[model samples]
Target: MAEMIEYNCPSCGGKLEFDSTSQKMKCPFCDSIFEIDTIQQYYAEMENSDKSTMNWDTQAGTEWQDGEADKIGVYSCQSCGGDIVADSTTAASKCPYCDNPVVMTGSLSGDLKPDFVIPFKLDKKAAKEALNRYLDGKRLLPKVFRTENHIDEIKGVYVPVWLFDAGVNARMMYKAEKRRMWSDASYSYTETSYYSAVRAGKIDFELVPVDGSTKMDDDIMESIEPYRFNEAVDFQTAYLSGYMADRYDVSAEESIKRANERIKKSTEQIFAQTVKGYSSVVNESSRINLTNGKAKYALYPVWMLNTTWNGNKYTFAMNGQTGKFVGNLPVDKSAAIRWFAGITAVATAVLFGLSFLL
Candidate 1:
């Protein structure tokens, strides 16, 4: 077991501190850097890694006693080379000044690495405004929630994600049937013919994205889709300077499996579209290749706000850096019903008057 918290400056031998906003445990003394990957290696070298890794599925989660000294002592920020003081138990934070997501960098002692990460670029004020604008256009919402639901407390969080790009040289062989109809004087006969063909093409999927946390579900992450991978700069702690970030808990190996599943589904659809008019089908052969596999441990931005409506928790999220709106909205059902009923009654009266006039 390692010390619960430890800080040392490698460059100047001065004390170091973790910056929650920058997402890096930086050596304020020397600006020398390190990331969570270093800690994982440290413990792994000592064969004492289990003390740091926590199972997300468990209720107690990580069993990280607030001050447990046995936990992995330190994490360095990969982006900034800063030393980050991570709660060996908790998963998320931002650097105090730089806004980098200093997260646990790796989980694998075996073979796996992230393909890529979409960094956070939007700031807090911009994210809040995005949520407000999303609310503004929505009609039939409670006036209170529209205005009273304060976004002041919306925490800017950057989630972990995986990105993968593959070149698929697809060779699909299938059998298909086409239908034809011919009309006699009084009746029509329909005839169907079967055909066999092979379709082959190469598609280069630039960057298919996947979210890497069970903390927030994939559905919401997908909702805020099309992360601009081309705009992705090399992962930097400065990008996380003013936002929160979660370390990668789900493994890259696990997420790559998911990415493959998505690719398979997409491939099937593409082939189906190409081979139309098929009553019954058979894909005798299919091929896909993961070309130029690249992965990175990255932090994505999200604005999480926990609001209560009638004793239930309604969590709201806006893309912290992009300002994309997400999360379950808080609503007053009684107010919604009243508004609907009132509108219905007025509409009914108008319809009745128009009918009478006609």
Candidate 2:
């Protein structure tokens, strides 16, 4: 049976929440910090003690008691397992979750729904203003791209993501060097010392999010990071009334690889910063053992726009809550060439004038 589990703080019988800023599980009642491993172990022992199995009837769509279902039409995207709901009169031409063509299909009866969602704080007008601001003050951008390229689509989407919580045991070694120099009347002398540095520690990572959509670019998505987890609320189908959402097509297992990569990189960098007082430090080897590796499914809000120019597509995305915008626009090659030539001409002319004066 599908069960919703809430982790309680061991220090006090209160709900334990993942604090994004501190990257730890904090108990509001007792003001205690905990490693996620402790909670996972507790849940595991509880499951083992009670071995009875139960089946639950999980209905996908929300039951409509007010006869509002007649006006709501649900469609699915073929490229990605994105379920889109809109008004019956409005045609869903593209999947807002991934910006791909939509194919009408039945509701996701077997899909796992998100546990939490961060509703859109910024509206379409804010997104439009942000897009315009992003286009402004860019001289290299083609004038036509800024003015004539119509935004093919702009959508507010609840993107699927996997949030990972883990406690990691890390060991890192580095080759460090110290340099000293002395100058005498006859010659200069230099001395260098090399040493091996080793460090090991345990650190916790809370709510490290990885986008769970196949069509979304990982790098581009990461650029708009750091959703305030504190603002997330219990998931409800009513939140999807005016927005689009999707069930994860990429499983948590597939998404874990990227999370691990990012966590490992972060661990190494954080530890390296601790090794100070050395002129130079280079990583020799590092190892990380992850424990309490847990994943929570969530939906994050994003304002997305897609347009085509010169047979190529350009996409822009904004964090619906923070208004952090990120997208790569097409560069004007002719404009760049002209700029380069103008700078070179001015430099050469100045040099010639100086030579004549001399």
Candidate 3:
């Protein structure tokens, strides 16, 4: 059985939920709020609490006849003591009996704990509004998608990611050419000068994030390019109160290949910027060496929506910090045909007018 933790309001003992607007835990019943720092102490004590009192008598419950409960996991809610049944990958969830947010402490313990977390900055309401704005000017989007999509299904999640930092030393050689053209009364002259350019420098990159969960599509995650790491705080289970979180199943070692690829690409681009003031430049040879590479486990906030339209499921993701939204929408074939037809008609009319004038 997994252990669950819940935050309760100190003032009125009501269930405390994290409020995005206030950036604090607010009690729904008493309206009292507490800052994150204050909650940190409570979390510390919970972490250091004695485990001897947690032993449960296993002989009381009925045994599973066979492999019936293989995929199921049960957790004891700290607040209501109700059994919270969840899948193996669920790190955080809400208790149905008492309606309090619960975090699976065992999943986030020891080596699995995240180092940093970006709390939810945009609430669920903002996500819905962003979805509306996303669909507003999309002329070719299916009209029925707007009416049939489930907006309320949108959820805020703290997605696990690996933030990699490294210092790169690169030496690159480029072949560049400068061309000059001159025209005289009798003859035209053209001269081209070729030069070999070499650039060597050291550059550092910080917090290059790669999605750590296999369940999230890497392309969509990359499309929402950048979460502000400056706003990230030390990870606390309290911050995940009202949201769902995934414990990273992908090891940091497995993610190092992706991190290296991104760092190498960035190093090449930055070095290429230095080779300028030429008509054209092409890379001749390049060598890059990386040092002090490190990876940190962190959670970034994202608002995700999954909807099915016309028998195809669409997934949308929004950056909770920056409010950037991205998703692939189904295009209406009829509307696309009409739009292309209009373009063709205009082009033919313009060509005919030009021929008549000539």
Identify the candidate with maximal TM-score.
3
Expressed as tens digits, the lDDT of each residue in 179-282 for candidate 1 is 78899899999898888878888776645667777777788887776566665544533333334555566767788877777787787678767876667777
Return whichever of 1 and 3 wins on TM-score.
Answer: 3
Per-model TM values vs. the true structure: 0.60, 0.69, 0.88
Which residue pairs show backbone clashes in model 2? none
lDDT of 3 by residue, 1-358 (tens): 6677778887887778889899998888998989988987876776689544676554566787787675466888777788888866577888889878888877788998999999889998898899889999898998888877775368788889998888899999999999999999999998999999999999998888889988788888788878888999999888888888888878888888898899999889999999999999999999999874668999888899888877788889999999999999999999999999999999999999999999
A best-first ranking of the candidates according to their TM-score comes to 3, 2, 1
| Candidate 2 residue-wise lDDT, 1-358, digit = tens | 1122345667776655444334455666698976555656775797799876544353676688786876666554434545556554332235568554331222222356678878677878888899999999998999999878789989877778999998889999999999999999999998999999999998999999999876577777799998899988766433443455555668899988888888898999999999999999999999998874669888888889999998899999999778899999988899999999999999999999999999
Off by over 4 Å in 3: 43-72, 79-82, 96-98, 182-191, 354-358
Give the lDDT ranking, best first. 3, 2, 1
CA-lDDT, candidates in order: 0.59, 0.74, 0.85
- For candidate 1, the TM-score is 0.60
Better of 1 and 2 by lDDT: 2
- Per-residue lDDT, model 1, residue 121, is 57
TM-score winner between candidates 2 and 3: 3
Quote model 3's TM-score.
0.88
